[model samples]
Target: MASVTFRHTSVTYPDGSLGLADIGLEVREGEFMALIGPSGSGKTTLLRTLAGFITPSQGEVLIGDEVVAAPGRSVPVERRGLGMVFQQHAVWPHMSVEQNIAYPLKLAGAGRAERRARVAEVLELVGLGGFGSRRPSQLSGGQRQRVALARAIVRKPRVLLLDEALSALDEPLRADLRAQLQAMSKQLGLTVVHVTHDRSEALAIADRIAVLDGGRLQQIGAPDELIERPASPFVARFLGDATLLRGRLENGLFHAEQVPLAVPAARITPGAPDSTQASMDVTSASGPASRGPASSSSAADGPVNRNAPLTGLLAVRPEQFRLTAVEGSPADDAAGETPAGTSPVNGGAGNTPSGGNAADHLTNAPSSRDASTATGPGARVTSGDDDPPPALIPASAPARVLSSLYGRHSCSARIEWSGLEFSCETALWRPQPGQAVRVDVTAGTFYPLSAAGSTPAARQEGEHAA
Candidate 1:
């Protein structure tokens, strides 16, 4: 097995169009690295460059310590010690599986007996034992694909490249094949680079994923890291169903038109001059709740300035939002009476009220009262005492359900609040359209609009400021 590296690699076509732009990445030996992006995002171009089908216009391509591609010089594809599978299972209809698997060995001048032994070995390895004599026309699509895989690995090449190898199969078949491919790679300790457009597939199969867009490399990391801490708005939107809200960060809170949420201090990275502290108090609906000391000296992590208000974007995933039905709302009382066993405050016997605390329904949420409170745009709620109430701290916002999609396990609702639409997961509560709901954001990641190293497209997409 061998590691692969691309250093400052670029590909410029004859029409002056750029296919890859200054790409740099490394695939460790025996690592399953997945390359993923939308169409025209340079994923295939990078793979082709590595396979010697396309030479880099600049920079170098190295396999292990040997520089195989550099500028005008290149290595022949046949001598690269790489095996590749494409979207189409290009098996010959007239050739038997054994003949197909043995073709490479024949080209290498292996004797007949040796070729037969190697073909039998790989056939059993790919779970196609004793099916070698079956013609491609007689085999199922999945079997044909297995034959293709067997042919590719028969040579025992150092690197295996898979370009949408399972895309042609059905979902169940694709899943089965994916599991098989993953096991095969590990069992053989093969260095693999898989190019795929399926986000879930890449997340499930690869050790690390590299994202690309507009001929440039986007963020690359483990699946959880990309989902939890995306480097840019595009990554957040692409990798999952995340809603980007235009807002400003002030006093350690993210404030939109009507949605006010306490930003987790850990998500705040230090970059701006205004950043000088790392901790901030998270205010609940009732009153101020102490998070920790606000002094930068006490923070174990570096400082993050929350004193100055900065325009930015907040990315919220569906699961991170807790939705609670509003009490006495038109949708809830549309029948002109409360449901048989439910009430306004404490849900009655064997009943769950729409107005009940959201935490009672979802396991991952805090109490709806403790999470946030619905307030109008720029409206502040006080303790309702004679003395002046503390400044309105970040909490929750009121929303109206626009549509609902019922899944087998949960229901996802499209909600509108302050002229912004968000997709939220409603656990066990089937909210109807036009129902008034309260949206409580349990967690969110903030990215300043002016953050450095962000792509122009990302900045433009995240500029949904109200």
Candidate 2:
């Protein structure tokens, strides 16, 4: 019903401690905006500022077009037209659910019949239709929280605020309540701002998420955007399980000293020119020598250089790395020969050639390390199986599995490549520990460490100050 805005807002305590630092963001009308961060990150400070509990030392907080919080003037919390639910379900023990929900309408002088009708409607909305007569003392934790929710929405407020509303409930109940809350917000067209430390919850429900650290806004974007193209290393590490590799970008290819890996610059930097062809050509021509040292100039056969070299970090998630069990030592594959019974796996994203026993191809030959064992947990080892072999990447770096965790549909492995550890996921092939495998970076994002406003010192200062 109403959008929320924080325009250059800041909060400072009496002792000169900063609560928020020049924060600016907007929550669209009828949008579910989630504010997330660690403890003392200023998310709660921002929420309290919007609720009129804390006034901004400078700038202003606006609800729709009205300035509700500003220096020397502020609206009263009771008149802000906001419905709020906190971690604790603050329901009266002696009151029935219907009475608790109707109390807000009673305060506004609504007639008994009108209050009863509104209470009944919200009780049904929160999935407590037939339990309104029960007292809070008799209800389960989840039911009591639902009662708290029904009470908050009974008066049909324009904006709703949830500060860890479901954190006290169990996982299953929390998940169910999250779905119900999303539906309720849409059906009622409420502008909602939810604050939680749970990243998964925010990613699951928010139209957009605002990440804060050290009393400063880190980055705000849709869930996928933050996960795929994080603006900084802190954001990438905070949002998902990403392995950060220090590297340098030369001629549109990322070169790192920790491993023999070269990722196309285009994959790491959005909108960068596609240099996959040039990189592949260079790798084919130079073989393992390409990973040795940086060349002062681009390859004679490579494309013309358009962007300058950059020194920064590369963020690669587990799912972005493709793995293939090496039939023999990497030295054997360097001769460009496919083994006796195995075919060269295609080198494209999500491409798997048909008609091969994956276990046979992976287990038939002796590895140089002699560590290749039988199929791992949940592996299908039958011959003539429909499941195809994993892709054999030509320019992949060599790595050995240190450990593995098997899930229902996928297996995650901890691999050590060139003295660096990385986490990778495999869905089709189950690689055992000490097994030699080729690790290829299927996709990654590069962040220039020298970029403005993304300095590590600034992030560290914020974290420490918070």
Whole-model Cα lDDT of every candidate shown, in order: 0.67, 0.66
lDDT of 1 by residue, 231-269 (tens): 655566668666656555543344564354444322233
User: What TM-score does candidate 2 reach?
Assistant: 0.73
TM-scores of the models, in the given order?
0.75, 0.73
The lDDT of model 2 is 0.66
RMSD of each predicted structure: 11.8, 12.3
Q: Which whole-number lDDT from 0 to 100 does residue 117 have in model 2?
A: 88
Backbone clashes, candidate 2: 0
Best by TM-score, which number? 1
